[model samples]
Target: MSKLFDLGLMVRTYRDPLAWLTLFVDLLPIIAIVFFGWKAIPLVALYWLENLVIGAWTLMRMLGTIAGNILNLPIMLFLGPFFCVHYGMFCFGHGIFLQAMSGNDQGGAFGGGPVALVEWALGTAPHMIWFVAAIAAVNGVFYLVDFLILGGYRKTQPIAEMFSPYGRIVTLHVAIILGAGLMMAFGQPLLGVLLLLFLRVVFGMALNMMRRLKLDGGLPKTLDPFADMQVETG
Candidate 1:
């Protein structure tokens, strides 16, 4: 463990092109799969593995104290499956819902039917709760790590700061939910989803522009890089 700690410190101290390249390459096959479909799973898995390796390396570098990693290991283990199922349903159900809303007759595509709606609600419920929890957990770990490494700021302050992003994220999530509910109430959930998607896309682009300018923190400051990447590539 001590040896691994030394390695991670080394990586963090000296930025490596190979590490960044690995990240990019690891992400590339996943993109290709999105375009090409299941045929790319093998390559996708390969890339994912490489990405994990890079993540470990990067984590080691950023976190000198094993305490951060020790804490992150379990939460991340759970977060992996949590995000997979929640996001999988989020993607699949929301897609179907939007399609149905568009008058495509995609039954329960976006929770169109009562049964589908129930399933969609169930799938997203945990994420609604755990997303906040995971953010808190991660922030706690980072707080400890940062405190141990740099010895700056009060211990609790970092944890609070880390969770600050979630407050905004929760707000956006609520807006999306409210918009979706209004759509369902007005008997146009599909239209609501489509509009929501459109709003998300536009709002996302605007946020990206803000980030590029380092002008974050306002009405629409929360930016999910994953979401941005998806929109750009998607």
Candidate 2:
């Protein structure tokens, strides 16, 4: 409701240069789609699909860690790094897959066949490493803004705090999909991209409000399950 559209909060949230840079990065895919037409669809699909997959992976790890802690198990400690590495590999794999698919579809320099696809994938594999690293680097900045600047960690356990970005990714992806579908149905792809961007900003503001409430210890009782858990564990 009103909490989701707090303009004041939105203004304050994006005041930082890092926040603005993150938003700019988020807008790049939409820009590509608008300028490059359908040729950019595969790349855009790859980008968001990677986010969705990694988000799901992160969510699983967070839930696993939370459950392990609740049950007094030690396995969660070992899972942290394992899940991170697995997520990185998953991103790289998707990057290669997208490259192969796009190359075959284009059928020019890449040609259309298994061998061409294999060659393209091999040649691009090293670049995919850099691509994955760049994604991690951007996400690192987001983590810093969310946790340190916004004080997200002050409001919840590390596992729960880690869940926030994944939650945002899933929500933003759904918004973009729905918005794009409606726009395409009406033959208004540009409008749809604009809608996607608007929804992202709205959702981003809502998330910031939630985080602020948590940091201030003002979150509703029912929504604050980890508060008591922290007290018990500490």
Candidate 3:
């Protein structure tokens, strides 16, 4: 609990420019919440969309590590499709839940699948295409810089890449879903929207710090299942 609102953690985490880029991406939803008059549905939809973005980048990270080992090819071939189908349905089902909560289960939009969910989500949030694109761009930058150029893949395995996102996603969304529920219960007030934004940014900071600690081999045992893994020094 004390760790959740750790401002010092955020200060250290955002010292990296890439972290600032992540913050920028995370903050984009605020524009709709403020100026464009978005409510919980759009905000949560944007986050659900961002999860797909995260899955896309995670898949790339898995692909990036294949050259590091021969065994990884089979693993990648198996898990790549597995992650796509599983994560797609995971997000799709979550989208359907959000639609049901928002009082919409129309056959055309939420009826189809992930693509339809994406379209429905973007339509719900006015000018959300740009926000979603911003998130994808930040993810692309991180992949190019941290995963590729910084040789994150050199020290990483497909399995680690596969499971790392779940921890982050689950940690962040529990609070998000709770906040959304409260916001919806209260008639979607502006204060609720802003609190949701703050909650996401704070959770992002926490997860990013944990990620850095994992990379540098500084994460405590409680937080470091991959503690046996060493840091990438090259």
lDDT: which candidate is best? Answer: 3
State the displacement of the C-alpha of residue 156, model 1, in Å, after optimal TM-score superposition.
16
TM-score, each model? Answer: 0.28, 0.51, 0.83
Each model's lDDT comes to: 0.36, 0.47, 0.71
Q: Pick by TM-score: which candidate is best?
A: 3
Off by over 4 Å in 2: 34-40, 43-75, 78-135, 145-155, 158-166, 169-173, 212-234
For candidate 1, write residues 140-226 as lDDT tens digits: 443344345444232222122222232233334444566667666887644544444444344333333333322122212212222
Runs of candidate 3 with Cα error greater than 4 angstroms are 1-11, 171-173, 184-188, 219-234
lDDT of 2 by residue, 37-124 (tens): 5233333343444464345444443544454246413445554665466554544454444554444546532344434543444343
Q: Roughly what TM-score does model 2 have, to 2 decimal places?
A: 0.51
Q: Best to worst by TM-score, what's the order?
A: 3, 2, 1
